[model samples]
Target: MTARNNSFDEQAVLHELKQFLPALSPGKTFTYRNPLEGFQEQTFDDALRHASEMLGYRTTLSLEEYRSLYNSKRVKPGVLEKVLVEKKGAANTFEWQDKVLMKKFPAAAESPSKIGKLRANWQKQYKTDLDARVHPRLFRILGNYLDHGVSDWKFPVRGKGFLDSMREVESNSFVSAFNTPRARNLLLQASSSINDLLTVIVGDEMLFKQYLFDQQFAHRGWSGLVATLEIGREISPNGSNITLRELIVFELLLEIDVLDDRLGRHWEPLSYRLPAPPEDLFAPVPVGEKSEVLAIWQEAVEWSYYEAILAELRQDPQNTRNQTGTRVTETTFANAVDSLCIIGQPSLLRSVTAEHRAFRHGYDFSLDPNGEMLEEILEAVVPSLGVANLECFFARTGLAGMDDILTDQMIGLLGLADTARGDLQAPLPAGLTKDFEPMRLLCVVEQFPETVLEVIDRLAVQSTCVGRRSVGRRSIALWLLNEWVHLVVIDPVSRELRVLKNRKMITYKSAPRIVIEDAVH
Candidate 1:
């Protein structure tokens, strides 16, 4: 079916969109097909093998990680027993338990008993998995494609436009047999328009369909949003979903940033572009508002990280382990921050402290002459994420005082320019372990007054989903009034996020509940 638009081929674009649908749909909907549609007919083990063999996707647990989990009793005997019973009953009990599990967790034949060598082998084998197999250059670009909010530095590309940067990435990417002349031609042709892109990118439509079975698994969340956009659902103001066309514009802007960074050239912003100007694509970030818009997007991305980790903490409590080796049931900034890559905002850090203090002790809001008490409490509730964010913010602002806590991982990752790597004036805190510095910093935030836990409890009670469920991803719900837009789900639960299909006044207490499809473990 062709859209009303004359310039682009709608049917082809829709076909490409089908490949990009999210693998995991929110449980708000009824039973959905597994994302790995091609391998759906196969058993779990067979599917893992097929996926890896066909797509080079490392879909199964690494043998090394599996062995560690099995030895540590993290993969409990009961679970294994249940799986064995479900699969083979009592027929091949001994062989299944000993030989089968052993085969699954195969050790490198050359260094079966050598820990260091096995680790090295696993790292190399897994590093070359799936995404990398998609043509090493595409993999590197995808791996290092840092969003503006996620990293301070831009991609080191000398491209003036999206296609140009892609060309640069193609040139620098690891060359392999997969990147054939045909593939190169396809990439080049795809950039002409949405129609050409869809038709050309998926070369030999039938063959490409087999190889690129599920694009959603390629990048779950973002691709999921793209799928949602294709479905023509009503987007809440806070919904991160944007049109495919708009995404193209954003990609162009990102490439412009890369060029500007590398060549120190002032490229025109999207708004100034004539003939299909980007301003017509979406809400254009004005020249003056660019910084503020970037800041807000950065904030949203940060909160997404925070909320995501919090969800994991709530759901995967069994996995959370600290330096002292205790199970952490409650949210910890260190755990949350460590699980994610993006840095937090200084302002959010301060707000969390103030909110906690007010919630812990019944404090009158209007009576405080200044936010002095809030500041003191802020010092107490600043998590390791907050500290990292502060350090990053300080580095960008040319301020100092966090050099001692900077881990080797961070120093190597950030690769801060000398001018940005400001000096630390304060003495190193005694007893800070190199690996567990985040944990030590977390100790300070842990001491702050409690309230977020209670908030979690309230959300759990209010959640529409039945039985025990750990929260999953939460998103902002954008509601539009006559002409203005407002955020409805300021602190939304997973269920509320799902139910925000359209925009309207949301009464948190009286919202209609959708039937629970599956409990988020």
Candidate 2:
């Protein structure tokens, strides 16, 4: 019991291993498992019976601490007997050629939705849901990620890595199949979800080796999603292979180059718009047009604009004294260039790949090859986030040919943040709305951490979890983080980003599937 005789022995275990050495064959294995119950019931007899000689011959005791008496053995006397009875009963579930345990789509349930619902229902009906604990595929995936990082998660090509990740997901009893017509429709509508589909379409071996092998990114989950999308397009071979919908999405994507949310910057904007999308938004830009487009992270804009307002108010204190008539200077366009280039690449000249390589030594970029593509993306997304500083920044710097960036909300937030600094007589810029909602949430936490419990109580009704119908506070934090890390606005002295978004208070609950009937009233 004191880590001596009771301790399991390795030398004796090796000796006991000799007993099965002669019998191992094509199908025989020392690590025999009850193939159907998942990875839960794996075993070998001598492996257990043989004690570690390191224990010096003391009795090996195996006891249920809850029970009064003790036994000097690893397991109960009847566990193997009970297991054998079940195995004999399960003979019908397998065949010489097919095994449920080995199959990709096993008969765990009629559907994926049923997987989770059944567990919930079974727990209610039978008073116990033991399946919650054990699942073969999922555990392996989790173990692979936790210990070895994401690199080991690949499956379906070389080995069982993909199968393992899938299994782990299923074991949660939370995942549902693309079951039901509605669920299928949802997946189709989620064309923006390029990352999820990448996993399904790509060869498993490629993914495991490329993205997972390196832990360069903070959240492997997010990084994997971005990298997957970038890699998935090449796998398809065809002038006429993929569906019309996929082609359309891909075409649109090509017209406007992407600045992945992964860049970790805040896009500056003011307020939300009812969104009468611009004409060019629907009309795809010509394939070979040269344009200058800025891919600014959403929050970085907020930080940038907030600071600009600071220098303005500090220098002229009275111009914005009345919030209405103060217009931000075009200097922001130049400052925007300065701000963006600050975080850019200590120097873009250091790296110039085909993707980011500006055609003509970064001309007005208005006529450069990369410019035309980025123009469409920036124009399309900028107005919506309402970061006018970015819009103004873009056009002012000639990143785009047209479109002023100043929007009502971004200006208002900038004004408000400046006002807060002036009002609190606290020397920091102030920052609201659904767009700023996450920022506001973060601001509150930084100023007052203790109120987190109370804050979640309010967010429960207001926020939605990621991948859900409504956006939750946590998703906002993730979205905010993309910008927080980039828009490096320190206290300028203490060198700390005082504004931090606390996602801790945000809860992540799986989304509920619902059937809806759309009709014209």
Candidate 3:
């Protein structure tokens, strides 16, 4: 096509785009890409397709007219037959600085008045009439459908009359509660159901399954969620397994802004097994006699709730310890940075933020209610960091291979203790098999070079050996002078000790202080 003709064609299509795609306001986006053959009137058709979907459009163009337009070679695929709409939600960049998110309130203001006012307003305006909203009802009914089974939805704007309704709730009752504030809690239970259904759906049918599939440990998250939702049938309706329902519940717990759970949450009412409260040592373990407890807690759940016990174990005096932790394991936190090095989860640990970070004589770890609270600390700190910062963590913890500042005694003692820990719980497949393993072992010395000397200075302790002996492990002491880690390790079988890591090579000129020498074994 000549440049002049191309200009004319472009102008004509641009005109049509304005007429057809009138719904694409600034900041709203819709997508349409056509895969037609050669010489297709690419621009006009793409614009037409873009405009069609704005107002409940499902088809781009009718067959007869489209054939005539394409037969004469007025359009071509991969040329102009791609539709772009405005992306939605939020204002533009430069409006907020990159570091704007880093700036948090000086302290959390727990203003009751504002919260009370918002609650009152919510009950009056939204809570009262939420049950009647069409979108909200769709969200809820969908959940019920998942938990109960809904291969046949007639899309009847009414309830109870649908096949799903006749089998579960009374049609009349469903019609009455279809779009009301009363059904909101049911919606919340449905998220797990949807999560389960979607995984099954994608797993069974999708072509490019790996990309979209949730591969979080055989979809354990979905399984856990489904287990929770199945209990909802007696509490919700027969089947209200939907994603929106879970979002409502998550939002409520996280203190995030979301639709009211009763409004759009999907759920299955509980008839058989209602979920019990979290079980763990965090729960009051009445000592004298084993009282008939209401229920049991998973081992992970049990261990997770022991932050107070952990704090006490550390011999805290001030009691100013923050004891809450989250569901983060060691491997997940470490893997967030580089795949080249893999750190398996010896135990679930809480993540620490700058606010909660602390240091003692031999090691550093927050006063978590449970012994491991790394997941919690990381949640707050991970977002405000560089990709490289992912591996950076509190270095003073008893974990070995994380740093080199600790003396061979401190390092060895930790490994032996960890070795004994194998008696408590078996070490996992990817987990490290240390003669003494370090608990909540964190090392960021290499990543955060500025703290290397400071950490070494703190490690200069006289009685670190006592704690090491108590734990059945020892620490290795060395310096990362120049660019090498000059260190030592003790052989478990020999009984007599030897050089840990003699000078093998020195490469990086940027780090010049390190020197390597042959130390006799």
Candidate 4:
């Protein structure tokens, strides 16, 4: 132990080994600490890469998870664009967006250390599981030895170091953990250092560190506890002395004993089966396409949420009312039907048409009782007209001046008496009425006169008929389109239809249908 074998400093190696162990100790109180504290000096990306390569940790979300967020609009287009511009600049925004959104990358393969691989051949080739035979007994012994207050009975020679206690127990006990005479002899000796145990098992000075890491990390929970206790971060209530070096020595001896019993004493050191020296665990991790794609997607997903927060922060406090007070209302079914009745107003008609297309493609409309009733009336009319295209049925025809016959028919449809006409009717707004036309009303009546008559005859018997009920202008317009039962009134003086909000009476006339047909044609 005085002279360094193969220039290996046991104290320095033990200190370095502590970096890879789990920092949190098992106890009543739970604490959080980074497991890769050894590589803390490196950048976070580099540290994660080292952990993934050397320790097999999944550091980020999978590509499929990010893609799901994109589909759900959680990863918004504007937010993703901002993220791309910040990372790759404006020129490369589209390229990065395509990679994050559409392009697929293969999963990165892990490059783990080759420390225990040679020993693993025994299990693969001979079908004998060394860990299965060794770990349970080893874990139980270590757990009992390290017990703070849980165990009923204490281990013998508890105050002595881990190796010394194990040696005393094996020497005195009839039922020994070591089945082989060689392992028993090695444990009994006072001068059995970690290097001496490694020499017996691995037979290669360069691989000693790797072999210890591989062995300890296999059961990191137990090894990490021993390492934590050795560092004095955790203390046992029963005063047990343990060193990571002593624990490694005992574990190597146990492995040797298991190998001898299972494969016999003639088996060679693990080094004899090695094809080549193992890779350095602390080497620079290679960046592949998968890592790059994952990095972009991760940033984009994060910024999708972050951009909204940043935008909110940047908004002026004085202008909060402008940002927050405005209510966005969706177009209702009533508004849509009313808009169709406008003639000569091409811009208004085009906008309403676009809304209809959007609604068909899953855009939601604000619905109420009135809108729903209007929709029901349209549903009844649309089929009788033999037109599946609502747009075609509601299409604008040219404006014509209101006449005496058309005026009387419009009054009859409103269920209005001649005297009451003046009560309900108001002069249409100056410029709008001058240009307004009831094109949707004209399209239904003129194009399908016989069909409109037939539908009115059928609806006259139904309870849903607008008999004596005061209905809005939009409802009157929809019924006019369905059965020509009501002519949506243009201002009698102005000769233009009032399209929205004005309430008028509804009366169904069963006789004198020909007069309505003659007026329409």
Q: Which candidate is the best by lDDT?
A: 4
- How do the predictions measure up, each by TM-score? 0.27, 0.18, 0.16, 0.55
Better of 1 and 2 by lDDT: 1
TM-score of 3: 0.16
Instruction: Report the lDDT of model 1 for residue 3.
Output: 17
Q: Please identify model 4 stretches exceeding 4 Å from their true place.
A: 1-6, 28-32, 107-128, 148-154, 308-521
Count clashing residue pairs per candidate: 3, 39, 97, 1
lDDT of each: 0.30, 0.23, 0.22, 0.48
State the lDDT of candidate 3 residue by residue for 1-521, as single tens digits: 01111112323322232222211000111111111111012222232222222112222222222223223322221111110001111342222211121222232134311111212223353443221332233334333343323323433333332233423443434453333442333333334333233222222212111111111112222222332333222122332333323332332222111233443443221111113311121122232110100000111111122222232222222232344342222221112121111111211112222222322112223232231232222222222221122112111111111111222222122232433332211112113322111112222211122222333333323113221122111111122111111211111122122221122211211111222232111
Q: List where candidate 2 sits over 4 angstroms from the true fold.
A: 1-305, 311-473, 481-498, 501-521
**Of the candidates numbered 1 and 4, which has the greater lDDT value?**
4
Any runs in candidate 3 off by more than 4 Å, and if so which?
1-135, 138-166, 174-224, 227-490, 494-521
Model 4 / residue 289 / CA error / Å:
0.8
lDDT of 4 by residue, 1-521 (tens): 11124666677788888876753244412222234446544544455556556665444456776676566555555555655665579898778767776776654544343334545655654566767777777766776777654444468766777777888898888878788887889888767788777777777777677667777766665566577666654545656667788788878888888888888877666666656655665557888666666666654553343232223222232343355433222321222132223211122222222433211111111232123433444444432331212222112110111111213323332334566333221112123222221212212111122223344344434444332322233332333433222222222122223221112322211111111111100
Instruction: List the candidates ranked by lDDT, beginning with the highest.
Output: 4, 1, 2, 3
Clashing pairs in 1: 56-130, 237-478, 238-478
Q: Any idea what lDDT model 2 has?
A: 0.23
At residue 123, what lDDT does model 2 achieve? Answer: 35
Candidate number with greatest TM-score: 4
* List of clashing residue pairs for candidate 4: 490-496
